[model samples]
Target chain A: MFFLRRSLATSATADALAIESDSGSPAKEFKIMSGVILSRPPIITPEQTAFSKAYYHYQSELYKRMSWTFPYWFYYPKGTLAENEYTRVQPKLNEKDPDVLFNRDRNSKQDVVFPPRSVQRETEESARIYAKIVPNPRTTIADEENNIRSLERKLDRTLYLIVKRDGESLEWSFPATTIESGENLESSSTRMLAQYGGEDMNIFLVSGTPALYYKDVYESDGKYEGAKIFYLKSRIFNGLFKPQKESGIVDYAWLTKEELSSYLDKQYWRKVAGALSKQ
Target chain B: MAFFKPSFGTDLRRQSTAFFQCRSLHSSAPQFKSPVSIVHPVHHRVRYKKSILHPKYQTLLTIPKWDPRSHLFKPQAVQPSRVKTHWETTLAPDLMLANYSHNELKLRGRKHQEWDGSSPYHVNRPLRSPAGNAMATPDILPRTFRTVPFVTSIWVNTFNHRAVTEHAERNIPSTVMIQQITGVKPAPAYSGVSIMQWRLRKERNVGAVVEIKGAKKDQFLATLVEVVMPRVKDFQGIANSSGDKFGNISFGLDPEGVRLFPEIEGNPDLWSGITGLNITFVTTAQTDPEARLLLSSLGVPFYGRERFHNVPNLDGTKQTRKKGVVYYENSQE
Candidate 1:
């Protein structure tokens, strides 16, 4: 496996070495070399291939619908704040003048204090109301979560601060699962497991030009619900490459054997038929 | 006595050969059954069906009867016979030969559909949003009782005639005559609009307050009433008119008003050119919590310049504050 260092400097620092010859003679004995040959390339299983394709397809579909922004602001009409209504404004460290606050007591002289004509921070009630119109991320995150996932539990969006090679600021969002999964996202193998279900189950992953599938029968509820197989499928052109997208299938339960029996059995049920026919 | 000893020697020679033959037969039995035991489910089904259909034929055709002297055919039990056949086939020189390939090919196709829907999406169908016509509301519902101090201007660029020409031939809307004259689409016609510019403030204010010192307060108020207010209403509950494409919109303080207000322009610390405007409403119904949450979740940037409470310098320290969103989660009182 190739280790991908976040920076070129770190990559340069790492080295692998091997000693090829053990001869003791002076001229013949001396060559120390660096570099390791991988005995085998990491095998890309059919399931892994299917999973990555499905994920990319889902991402592309989401990117198309990303253009629209939500509308849900509270209405505050015109002429709410009076024209001359003002209050004691707070000043920066250097801008602070103790005389400005004390000089404007109601009993002393004027109810409203007016300092020099120089502008200070205008903490107007209208500005506050206007500022409120800004969208809060916490609420958006919550709303976005509910719109997607089927489970009641929320998917945590953890951000990783990263700087691009060009020195641009960047952040990455790691998809969330149950907290029990683990805290260190870097070590979480669940990401791979989540994409492609377990092995030892009857499954065939097809990867080429889209139509990807992740089919595995696990035990969910009492009556072999988990064994009920599911496949995540999307066309390459329609989902991954299409400029427009309509919707996504986040979570879907597998059909029971009885339910599957009603439909004319086609190609997908090869393994299913083999297992059931044995019985 | 010598003749009796000669008979014993003859019997011993014959017994030795028989014993060696029996050992050879015992060793072969286990080797034969090993292959049948490891058959995949597909192979098992094929054997099961074949055995049930033609049992009598196998019994009469192969192998000798149990009686050693008779030398007649004896029927073997299906299980034992299958076990023997499995081993024979497995150990054969041509073991890798394809026997059930035709059957396997047919099964593979069946597996594809069950795993994922192989059918293509019906592209010709009309696009329908899952949420349908439901509109979003702010997370923290704006307080009607709380007096607003400034006017909140939301710019809605419903349809751009210039952009439409590329997709399909169309003329600019009659309202965009100003956009053509100035070569600048008025703030109302800009594609992206955010209400968070007003929502992030600690104090309540009005857009009208900022307009007071501007060049034309009368014209500004007219724009607020005639153009801005209608767009806000359109967002709140836009009637299903034939022309409404439901395009992008933004909410912020009027740039004109922000520039004119001396307090905003003079304070470099408080406002970094980002302005605010308050929205005032006349409402009778109790504000719904869901509506508030919806509005709070509007296209406010959780990151970037438009996040709530991320004043360019709110704490009065000169530190450059990064922008982030405040998720308003009101208690379920």
Candidate 2:
């Protein structure tokens, strides 16, 4: 009887172990519970509690003064209404060629026609791309080994294509450009190189998500206007490059990481370095 | 006199016999000299004899102290003179060799003594080598390992009221609200460009703003996550897709939602009108997923999909309709 009981206990323990290993459901539940249990308890001051009571009273009074209306179509799936509207009016809008609408702003009497603010204004709908072009890999075994050795030694040596901005003063920067509407990141980067880089260059997209930059255009009256820049990376398979003067690139040079530091600010260089190292 | 002399002889004989017995006992018993010998009393040593196999085995297996063959396993003794000039005799001569074969063999192995593309371990060989052409191989991007999420700063802004009328009401309440919420005095924001529609003029003070950082930022976030957000009615989690693709996520709160804060809710008389606020969480994470994970770990809820319900359409057809309720995954479940 003792042996029988011992066997039963061992089997039960084994079954428990099997259940623990076989199914992830229990573990997931435990994780969620742990997350909540591990969080620090909130501390509320007496004054805060009093304030909340007063706020609730104020909100009640405000509610009495105003009647609320529920938003229409809150439960409808996305694109249903837009699809219906598009089917109804698309033919008429298309006949006129919608591209003309953009040009009409140029002829409008108003000097500046600000685009209508989007309902969601936190992030831009359109994504930007930034590219870092690296030199081709060495072909010979010895050269490759040397490259590896240098990298192991933390002796980073790479050439960066820096362009001179044609502004109030000549400011040096990497070959970066904003992605145009209807064009993808890779194509935009290639076009930017062709236009500003000055020379025929072959390049391919390097793996990794683009680095993001938030440039605050203006900050006034508690309103902030900003642009998001997505930085990407690419390797120049073949290219003979020169800086173009017509594109505001008066001068250009292949500079090492250390040399690039002297030309670019710390923040700007950090972004460039991030894209390069991502390769 | 004869009797006394006879007794003295007998006494002498007895004394000699006792002395001879003492000598015999002393010679028979083992004498110990070393301090450790105290542990092995003479009687104990006699009872347990030393095993003959122990010393025989030890002698057969033990390597000699000065054997050069054992130098690989044991540490080599360094002479002060040799240590001072060994680099000149060894390292310099190895370095001076034109081919570097000796150094290569020592550093790598015999297999890598000669430069061959097919060497099992080449310095430049890609880790987990790809099955195709080497030149066509993709480069490995560096991974930046970030451990903790930190709030860099919090920015609060309000709009300009000058465009409504010449006697347009100034946004004093908003400025006071920001000050009350942040516990810091707000600075006036100026317009950089002139916009005719909004009647915004360049260099005109349009709104008030306050930037909170360090410990104050932590306090504000605690209030936001623990006190304010949970109290919001019909509150769904922040959209999972929200973020600047980078680590920063920016979300806006309506005037109604902003009113839930204790700072705003506590003072009924101080509130004049509704003022909206934009809160941006800046994290050290490089990607949106990482940032969202970090935020969720901090107790900020995120909604997966918007909740939907069945409703009758205008044409008397039953249709599936969405409700304002966002389906939030109860992470604590």
Q: What is the DockQ of each candidate?
A: 0.01, 0.01
Estimate, for each residue in B145-211, the C-alpha lDDT of model 2 and write its tens digit: 2223344677777664642233234666677678778766798766678888776677776667788
User: What TM-score do all the candidates reach, one by one?
Assistant: 0.15, 0.28
Q: Evaluated with TM-score, which candidate comes out highest?
A: 2
Candidate 2 residue-wise lDDT at B238: 88
Looking at model 1 chain A, which ten-residue stretch has the lowest summed lDDT?
A33-42
- The CA root-mean-square deviation of candidate 2, after full C-alpha superposition on the true structure, stands at 41.9
Error of 2 at A243 (Å): 73
* Candidate lDDT (C-alpha), each: 0.25, 0.45
RMSD of 1: 42.5
Lowest summed lDDT window (length 10), candidate 1 chain B: B93-102
